[model samples]
Target chain A: DTAVSQTPKYLVTQMGNDKSIKCEQNLGHDTMYWYKQDSKKFLKIMFSYNNKELIINETVPNRFSPKSPDKAHLNLHINSLELGDSAVYFCASSQDRGRMKQYFGPGTRLTVT
Target chain B: AQTVTQSQPEMSVQEAETVTLSCTYDTSENNYYLFWYKQPPSRQMILVIRQEAYKQQNATENRFSVNFQKAAKSFSLKISDSQLGDTAMYFCAFMKREQGAQKLVFGQGTRLTINP
Candidate 1:
């Protein structure tokens, strides 16, 4: 079983369109995160949720939003996608007090045309 | 804001040889966590190793090990007897020891290739 899994591993959409990526973790983790990896392979944290509460929201654009229906699931919705948004999006999770390990999913490769 | 830096953009090692990937980070928090993640061609982020700031003893897992210099703010990964399976993109990540969710600050990553 996959510890963390994301749907739509590779997504392609036109610019200005809306898309969403869903994530789930079977590791009984309470904290989940969304990260973006740019073309240069630079990874940056976009959002973090702990037990369905928003914890960390970096200086990301307003078009990006994260929803956590429960502690086990976190979904990302993007509005008015742009070419600059084309990158690999990753979902990660860790236990409530897990300070050393964060399990990650096979990232979603989003393409904005 | 804490930042992780992986100076080596790429590295290559022959099979059964050894390779070292360097990483450095800057953070204001005294107690934190450092990690090495491996991303293979399948594009999955796999935890290779982890080190806590409070622990002076280095962490080792089979063929993977880490040299954590807390005072120097440097954490490097050493792979002994590198195998073809070890070829992947290695990332250095840092997370604060806060009470809630941990936001991982990741480095640019180092691409490692193991030759046969």
Candidate 2:
């Protein structure tokens, strides 16, 4: 069984469109995170949630928002997506808040045209 | 702020040979954790190994081992008996022991190719 899973492995959308990427973890982890891997393959954290509460918010634009309905699900919503938003989005989860090992899901490739 | 650096952008090794991927980090806090992650063409990030700062002994996982130098602030990954399956983009990461919230800082990454 997949510990962490993301829907729509590949997403292709036009600029100014709104899109949502869903992530779910079966590991019963309390912490979940969203990371963006740009064209240069530099992975950066965009947001993090702990037990359905927002914990960490990077310097991401206001157009992007993350919602966690429960400890097992974290979803990312991007509004008015721009060309620069084209990149791979990764979802990860860990058991604790400290520096613990994380389990990542198969990334979602989002191409904004 | 913590930073992880993988000096080698790319590396290649013949099958059955051993290869080492170097990684160095900078941090003010004395307590933290280090990790080595591998991402193949499938773009799935997999944890190769992890090392805790308080532990003096190095960490080893099967064919993978890490040389953790706390004073030098270096953590390098060594792969023995390299196989083609080992070819992937290796990332070195750091995690601070912060309360409530914790995040990983990843290096630029090193692409290792294992040729048979």
Candidate 3:
């Protein structure tokens, strides 16, 4: 069984289009996170949710929104996608502890044409 | 704000050799955590090792280990008897010990190549 998984491993769309990436974790974790890796392979935190409550929000654009329906699910929705949004988005989950290790899902690579 | 820096953008070594990837971080907090994640061509992020700042002992897992210098704010990953499977992009991450959820600040990553 997969501990963490993401849907639409690869997404290709034109600019001004809206898209969403879904993530789920079977590890029964209370905290979830979203990270983006740009073309330069630089990884940065975008958002974090704990027990379905918003916790950490980085300096990401307002076009990017994260919704956590439950503790096990965290989804990213992008409105008016741009060419610069082409990158890999990773979903991770961990226990509600600062020192706990986070389990990462297979990233979703989004390409904007 | 916390920042992680990986000086070497890329590195290569022969099989059975050893390689060390350097990483340094800047943070005002005394207690934090350091982690090493490996991403191969498949683009799966795998946790290789972790180190807690409060502990003085280094962390070791199988062939992977980390040298953490708290005073100097340095964390380096050393792979012994490197194998072909060790080829991947290694990222150094930092997280502060806080009350609630923690966010990881990752470095630019270092691409490691193991040649046979």
Which candidate's lDDT is highest? 3
Scored by lDDT, model 1 comes in at 0.92
- Give the per-residue lDDT digits (tens) of candidate 1, residues A6-101: 998999999999999999999999899999999998889899998899988889999999999999999999999999999999999988663557
Show model 3 residue runs off by greater than 4 Å. none
Candidates in order, interface RMSD in Å = 1.2, 1.2, 1.1
lDDT (0-100) at residue A88 of candidate 1?
A: 99
Q: What's the residue-level lDDT of B46 in candidate 3? A: 94
lDDT of 1 at A66: 96
Cα error, candidate 3, residue A10 (Å): 0.5
Q: Which lDDT tens digits does candidate 2 get at residues B1-116?
A: 88899999999999999999999999998878999999999999999999999999999999999999999999999999999999999999998744455689999999999998
- Candidate lDDT scores, in order, read 0.92, 0.93, 0.94
**Candidate 2 error regions (>4 Å):** A97-99
Q: Return the TM-score for chain B, candidate 2.
A: 0.97
Clashes of 1: 0
Tens-place lDDT per residue, model 1, B21-103, is 99999988887889999989898888899888999999999999999999899999999999999999999999884558777
Task: Sort by lDDT, best first.
Answer: 3, 2, 1
